[model samples]
Target: MEPHAARPLEGRLALVTGAGQGVGRGIASCLAAAGATVAVNDLAPTRADAVAAEIRDAGGDAFGLAFDVTDADAAQTAVGDLEIDILVNNAGVPPGGGRPNRFAQMPPEDWQLQIDLNLAALMRLAQLVIPGQAERGWGRIIQISSGASSRGLAIGVAAYGAAKAGGEALIRHLGVEYGPEGITANSLALGLMEGVGRAGDPAVDRLIRGVPIGRLGRPQEVGEACVWLASEAGGLVNAQVIHLNGGTVFGR
Candidate 1:
């Protein structure tokens, strides 16, 4: 393959969760554009198929797989036969039903939901691919985290925040354990990205004002970052959290 060919990820296989729309869909499309055959996983079969069709229409190889990440049996059944070179864990639920609420008022089920989907489910999916990745001597695991994981920017997201923080910790641990085997793991802690989560909420304007960049982040920006991190150019960058919050928060 030519060094600068449009398909740098040619021959690779990637799986992106919650790729029916929003940030997940963007990342899936970007991966496919780089020449990877992509599996777009989403809870809704129709949505997943739509996004996958879009990728195919754009001349990229893609297919939709529907399964709830929190469902272990379903996840295993959907992903068992695939040889995935890249994994992007982007499925998650917004805190308090997309509205801020006091932690005191948060329901127990809400907290457990976040923990199961954002953290535990991620581990389950990673387990399916890490062994193969280690044996093959190459793999990329990217987690889509939130600014709340490390910052106080948002309110009433204690459960979500805690879950994401745990996810970041897991990424660091995975990096250390798998780095020598050529499997890199990292997390992207994003803030106020356009069209993602509750970006259109009235409270978002206040949040955006605090960002030094003076604007909401674009989904495409996140997608490009994923492409780089999953490519050879980012081989040495591991066990790190790349803040995509437009400088809203600094440091780990």
Candidate 2:
């Protein structure tokens, strides 16, 4: 038996949204390490550039892209010309920045923002890339969803959870629609992560205790899952939601 080799994603081009930091950045780095050329995208230009530079410094191929996923025109302009083999929809806003309200009390604008960015943005980006992918006969779409999408632990993020649920459904439909074209659509429902820059917070202790693993998931773990799904190893897998929550919630 021979030792397994890395670089399974060699010759692939990946575009990861909200990759300036957190899980997105980790996924970009992991894909790059696996020999994929990555486009590190974020709403802030500087953040995106920094991440891309970090990847380059680590001896990987990557570039920065700053664009709002919610902006259809900007998304089209940013991605229209690229031949992306993998798309990771990781951009989204968490609820409750002095705006924590119950579903009934939440403002309409807040709901719209969540839906537009979380659900609609994924659909729009998929539309833009699906054609090229279909033409080439290979593509991977990975949605970075949340545990709230399947559970009712949304609390103040009712809208966000709702949108994520919708996104999951859309991913399923896309899988069924495009599986014949060599495209796979799936989602990753992440729980409280250690690499979201929120490690060591006392507030997260309870959440960590709740996990079956008794710890928060690392960003690199999520990245590894993304790489596996994007690689040839996961070609037959589609329309599935892989929950990366360390057994925080199950039975979906």
Candidate 3:
């Protein structure tokens, strides 16, 4: 990326959920490196603090915010205290894809759990952040979606796909409703990537086979993309879901 496009995040505050590990941590670090004051949030209380410490050690302004995003009111209120200009909803658990009873014995509750975490809560959080963004007249909300959202998904992940698609729709709607308020909302439809839960499983092979790039993606790569979209360079870009699936699905 060009130097100017990267520097727009200077002094901005970015709050990332599930930031204790994986893609969330990567996004937080990258935003901090790009000059945003990152607020690293996660369900693991200690881990969030640890990452925040590391960021501070690197001379980046950051702090830990540990809370379950499913608690809609609490999550919103906690983030409301921060001076966040960017929001990254990266929290969710991975469905083993194909699982229990060879998919024949899947429980109704199990399926609903995935949707609640992956999709429903995201919609709530976006709504939570809107008031702050609109008041400021500038904000960036970036969500981490999934490649599973494209396929029927592995046996156990039908619900995951549904949730992710819901998230994508929510993001697009937010873009339309809030872009005029100077708040840009977008999603990074992630490809298979190392470090993500379940990425190492052989079941991922089917997902990878279709990739033109023929490789796993990295959290830093997604992080860099977030930096771009959050920058002024991406001002005109809104409501677009950028699928970072290494040519798996182009221009979705």
Candidate 4:
């Protein structure tokens, strides 16, 4: 067998948003390792360039593209004339970055921010990439969602959950509508993750204890899942919400 035979994503170009740190960074690294040239996007130019440099230092092909995913003009120009075979929507408001407010207490403006960041931004990028993908007759759309999309959280992030759910719904429709054109749309509803999960923090012990796997999900693991979805092996898995929450009951 050829040494590079295991690189299923060879010759593909992947664009990963918010890839400066945390989950996005992990995904970008993994995609590059899987033989895909990656375009790392982040709001901060330094971060995007840093991650792209890391990938190249590791002997992979990548470049940083700094732009806010929510900005329509910026998002459009970022992908101009580039043949992106895979699009990983990983940019969004961090779980606790937004003030926690119940729907009743959340001001309309605050909730609207959630919708714009989590769902609308995703739609914008998809709109920009899907046409080219269709023309090529091969594409992969991987959405990084949250467990809150499927279950209610008592933490006052109703808007966040709703926005994620909305994105998933869009993914379902896209999967069905474009399946005939060899494009697959899928959502990965993630559970608590290592970097994002705040593992070892006493405050979240109860949440950790609830996980059957007795651990937190790793960002690298999420990247591995993306590789599968973007590879030939995942051709048939479309419009499905796959959970990556360490066997949480909510996932089941």
> RMSD in Å for candidate 1, one decimal?
2.7
The digit string of per-residue lDDT tens for model 3 on 1-252 reads 224444668868888988888778888888888888888988778999999998889888889988888777778778766656898988877424333233456687777777778887787777677788899889898888876676665445666667888888888999999989999999888876765337566766655676798877888998999988988887788998888878775211
Off by over 4 Å in 3: 1-6, 94-104, 196-210, 249-252
Which prediction has more favorable lDDT, 1 or 3? 1
In terms of lDDT, the poorest run of 10 residues in model 2 is: 92-101
**TM-score, model 2 to reference:** 0.93
Candidate 4 TM-score over all chains jointly: 0.94
Alpha carbon deviation, residue 196, candidate 2 (Å): 6.6
Best by lDDT: 4
Query: Tens digit of lDDT per residue, candidate 1, span 1-252?
Result: 232456777888999998998888999999999888899999899999999999999999999999999999999999988889999999987422444467888788778888998999889999999999999898999999988888764457778888899999999999999999999999999877775337566676666777899887877788889999998888889999989987877211
In the order shown, the candidates' Cα RMSDs to the true structure are 2.7, 3.2, 3.7, 2.4
Query: Which model scores highest in TM-score?
Result: 4
TM-score ranking from best candidate downward: 4, 2, 1, 3
Cα TM-score per model: 0.92, 0.93, 0.87, 0.94
How far is 66's C-alpha from truth in model 2 (Å)? 0.4
lDDT of 1 at 188: 95
* Candidate 1 global TM-score: 0.92
Q: Kindly give the number of clashing pairs for every candidate.
A: 0, 0, 1, 0
lDDT of 4 by residue, 1-252 (tens): 111657889999999998999889999999999999999999999999999999999999999999988788888888867888999999877534788787898999888988988899999998888999999899999999999899987788899889999999999999999999989999999888775445577857877788899877788999999999999888899999999988894431
